[model samples]
Target: MNLAGRKVLVLGLGDTGLSMAKWLARRGASVRVADTRTGPPRLAELKRSLPSVPANSGPFRDEMFADIDLVAVSPGVPLAEPSVRRALDADIEVVGDIELFAQALPERHARIIAVTGTNGKSTVTSLAGAMARAAGVDCEVAGNIGPAVLDALMRREDAGRAAGLWVLEVSSFQLETTASLAADAATVLNVTEDHLDRYRSIDDYARAKARVFSGDGIQVLNRDDPRSLAMALPGRKTSTFGLDAPRHAEDWGLLERGGEPWLAQGANALLAVREMKLAGLHNAANALAALALCRALGLPLQPLLAALREFKGLPHRVELIGEADGVRWYDDSKGTNVGSTVAALVGLARLDSKLVLIAGGDGKGQDFSPLKEAVARSAREMVLIGRDALLIEAAVAGAGVPIRRAASMDQAVALAAQAARPGDAVLLSPACASFDMFRDYRHRGEVFRLAVERVIDAPKH
Candidate 1:
C-alpha cells in the first residue's frame, strides 16, 4: 500500500477524485487530477483540497500513462468508455476510491462493515451507523451514503483519533475495481439483476457485489433472497437473516405475533416489534441486519433497542406521503430494480386487498416477468409512466390487468388517485431508474410528495 516514489493519476475531479488525489499525494505519490468538465468553477472545492496539483482538465492524456504506476478512478466515470478502456490497456493499475481508502486504514482492531444492494443500501448503512453510535462505540460511517470515505479517513488522521468501526455503503461500480479490500464484516442485503447495460451479464454484477466481503470475515446475508442464499460464501462464519429468522446471534429479525413485532433469538423472545419507530417490514429487515451486525461485534443490545425506538427513517424509501379518504400514498422511488420493487410489494398488507401500483421508468435491461407477476397478484390497477412505459405495460397487459398511462408524475399521481378507492394503496415503486422523467430518485420522490400534498391539501368540499 506504500505509495512512495510511485506516480498515480486520478480520473475525474469530483469528491472521490479529490480525496484520492489528496491521499495519494500525502503518501508521496505524484498525482494528476483530471476531469471532463474543464473549468475552475467545475472543481473549486477540490482545488481548495489540493492547491499544489494544478487541476488538469480534459480526458486522460496518453503521455500521463507513460510513467504512471496506477490510476484510481472516480465512481462517476463509466469503465466502458474508450478513454478509460485505453488507460486500462496501458497496464496501469486501476482501483476505486474505496480501495484507496482501504489501503490507508489500520490492518487490525477496526471492523469495516461494507453493505451493498440495489436498494436500501443507504438506509441500512445509515441505520447501522446510528445503531453503532448509539451503543457508545467509536464508529464512523461513510462511503456512498453521503460523506466521502476519504473525508472520513482524513477525520481519523487528526491528532489523537481513536480506533473505531467503519461502516461503508458501497455500489456495484465501486466493488468492480475494489480488490484487496477485506472487510471484517459485510452484508449483501439482497441481489437482483441490475445495471445490465454496464456488465456482460447479471452474474458479473452479482460477483462484483459479492467481492465486497472477504472469504475469511463474517458474511451477513438475506435468507429470503434465493440468489444470496445460493452463493457459496466460503471461509467465513455465516450470519444469516430473513423475515422469519430469530433475533439471535448469526440470525436476527422481529417476528409478528398477535399484531406485534417480536424480536426472537432461535425460539427465545428478546423484545417486542411494537417498540420500534421504523415503519413497514423492509425497515424491520434493516433493523434486524443492524442488530445482527452489533451482535457479531458483541456490542450490548440495549443501545440498539434505544436506537430502534427512536430512529424514524430516510427519504424515498416507501415513505408515507399522505393518507386521504382512507387511501394511502407511498413513495418508494428507491426501488430502482424489479427485485427491490418485489421486496416492497411483499411487505405491504391490505385489508380489502386493493393496491394501485405506479411503475415504469428508464429501462435497465432487467427481466420484467417477476415484476409483472408481483403486480398482477397485488395490484387492483396499474399506473405506468416514464420512458419504459411500453415495456412495463407489455409485461403486465397479458395478465388481464387494467393500466392507466401518463406523461408525467403529476398526471400519473392524479390518475392513480382518481383510479383508487377507500382502503386502496397507491405505491410509486418504479422498478426502473428516474433519470428519464426527473433529475434523480430524490427529485422523483419529491415530485411524488408534492402530488400527494396537492391531494391532501385540496378543499374538503
Candidate 2:
C-alpha cells in the first residue's frame, strides 16, 4: 500500500498501463513503462501523461527487474512474458491495477461488485451500475468496462468520498495479476474457453476467473454453467442465477406462469421475461446475475428491475444493424471466442427463420468444436473470413451446412445476402478475435455495418 520510495515498472502502455504509470509516478513510485510492441499506439499519450518516468519501447528487459520493488502489469500484457517471469525470479511482486486500487481504498471502504466471465461481463457490469444509479446510489463503474480501476480510485479519493458502490468488469487477464481484491459481492457470470493464446489450458483460464471469489464476502455463481458453479468455495455465502426456477431462498432465476417466463427470486415473480429488452436467454442469465449482485449488496429490487427494462443493451453484441431483401442482419463483433458465438447462435435462433452465419478470424488457439453443435442446429450456411476460416470449416464440417469463404468483410456480407432467404437472419458472429483483418472488434463491427448498408442501399433487381 505504501507506494512512496517504491520502484515500480508499468508493463505495457495501453490505457490501463498509462493510467497506472501516471498514478504510480504521481504517488512517488519510481515508474518505468515498457511494451513489446515497438512504438505502441499509446506511446505519445504515455509520454505526455508521465514525462518524467523513463520508458522502454521494445521488448521487456530483464535488467529492469533487478531494481524494481513491484511490477504493475497491464491486463493486455501476458504474465507469461519472459521479463515478467524474470521479475518473479527476482522476488519482485507483480500485480495489476485492480490490486493497486484495492490497496488504495479507504479503510471504511465502499461496496464492491466484481463481475467476471467470458461473455456478458460488460453488459452485466453496466446493468448493475445503472441499477445502482436508478436507486439513487452514488456509484462508480470502472475496471475493464470504463476507466481503469486506479483512475477510478484516484477520482474517488479526489472527491469528498461517500459510502456507495464500485461496479467492476473484471477480465481473466486482470484477475491473473490481482490479489487482495475482497469484494462485497463477486460473480463469474459464466466461464468458457477464451484467451487460449495466453493461457496454458482452459482450466487455467477458469482458475484465473474463479479468483474473483477469493474474498470473504458473498459469491454469486451461474447455476447453469458447471465451470462457474464449480468455483463456489466453502464457508462463503453463495447465490445463483440461471434460466430454471430458483432452487434456494436467496437464488435468482426464472419461473413459468401461463406459458410465459418471469424473472424470480425464490418463488417471488419480480418481472415478466418479456419485459426485458435484452434478447436471448444468455442475456436473461446476465440480468439474473446483475439482480443477484444487487440483492447481495442490499440494493432495492424494484429499481434494479426498472433499470433492466429500460436498458437497451450494449452495441456489438447481438445488435441489429440493418434489414435488406427481407433478411435481418445482426452484428455481434464482440463474439471473439467460440463460447460467445455459440451462445449467440442459440440465443438468437428462431424456429421460423434460418441463420446465415459469417464467422472466422484469429482463432487464438481455441478449439472451435463447441461451436459445431450450435451451428448445426441454427445456421443454414457458414460464410467464413480471416485467418482461421478453414479451421472453423473443419470443425463444423459434419454439421451438414454449406460453407463459403470471403476475402473481406464486404464480400462476406454480399455472400450472406445471396444465401439468405426471406425469413433468414444474416449474423456476423465471428467466433474469433478481429486482430487478423481489422484493428479491433469495434472496427470489425463498423466495417460490418458499412458493408450491410452498402448491400441494403443498393438498387433492387
Candidates in order: C-alpha RMSD to true structure: 2.5, 1.6
Candidate 2 TM-score, C-alpha based? 0.96
Per-candidate local distance difference test:
0.79, 0.88
Give lDDT: candidate 1, residue 383: 88
TM-score of model number 1: 0.92
Clashes of each: 2, 0
lDDT at position 191, candidate 1: 83
Point to the candidate with the largest TM-score: 2
Q: In candidate 2, which residue ranges exceed 4 Å CA deviation?
A: 161-163, 350-352
Candidate 1: residue 337 lDDT (0-100): 88
